[model samples]
Target: MKTYYKDFLIRDWQPGDRNPAAETISTVLAEYSIIFEPRGADIDVLEIETYYQETGGEFWVIEQEGKVVGTSGYYPVKRGEKSVEIRKMYLLPDVRGNGLGRYLLKELENAIANRGFQEIWIETASVLKEAVNLYERSGYQPTTGIETKRCDRIYIKKI
Candidate 1:
């Protein structure tokens, strides 16, 4: 299924979207001076459905003028668990501050909620201030005890 938001088209990830999605992520990471590591292996967006679909998770891409410009998804933190981790949400610089992030987030949240997920967890780096702000504004609260060297900030929301 595809959703239209102004000139942007949001839809499930397709086979050809992987490269553009990876480029979008790479550009964002480089812009923020962050290095891509094994933890960021999901940059290979084409394989997202392979890893997430069996677990009732999904990967979405946003296109403008037929080019992939944004990506987001969620996956089970553990097999058969009610909790899922939001992953790989990135938008091109030109599209920021226009409410697309919130839109994509709501879509993902609703999809997971319908699939019986009870909680959403997200981890982001301090450098990505806008992302942290977006999550906080969307009702995610800071949670302690979870640690990751790649991402220092962790937030969770119970749905």
Candidate 2:
């Protein structure tokens, strides 16, 4: 297995990443539930992927030395509208301490902004304090949560 020690690359998710991407999502959801019980494994993986594939969402991944370290996504909030939402951002446990989280956020933000979206919104969990901090530090502000079965603490950032 490849180990990432220093530099990382953020790029659009491609067909080659599907299996590793699915594994990463499954692993992160399982790990996240250990801290806060939310986002069922099936929902985060299968359901979310079905939704993404249907809606033409763009997915991204962070790779280091041929290993997938993180994943994120950008999709239309509402079709024909200039709004978008960020989804399923995750980083492996070993890579969590470094600044890769913020780096991925900025990279995704820039990618979506370039597509003409005026703003981006993300819904995390109230218990995921580290995620919340990263969002706030990256210019996201708390917003009223959307009524969905998914557990979320919604935040939005204007691009």
Best-performing candidate as measured by lDDT = 1
Q: Candidate 2: what lDDT?
A: 0.71
In the predicted model 1, the residue pairs found to clash are none
lDDT string, candidate 2, 15-43, tens digits = 67877877776687667673322345234
Clashes found in each candidate (C-alpha, N, C closer than 3 A): 0, 0
lDDT of each: 0.82, 0.71
Candidate 1 C-alpha lDDT tens digits along 63-111: 9999888888888885224889898899989999889999889988988
Off by over 4 Å in 2: 1-6, 34-56, 79-81
TM-score of each: 0.90, 0.78
**Candidate 2: residue 46 lDDT (0-100):** 41
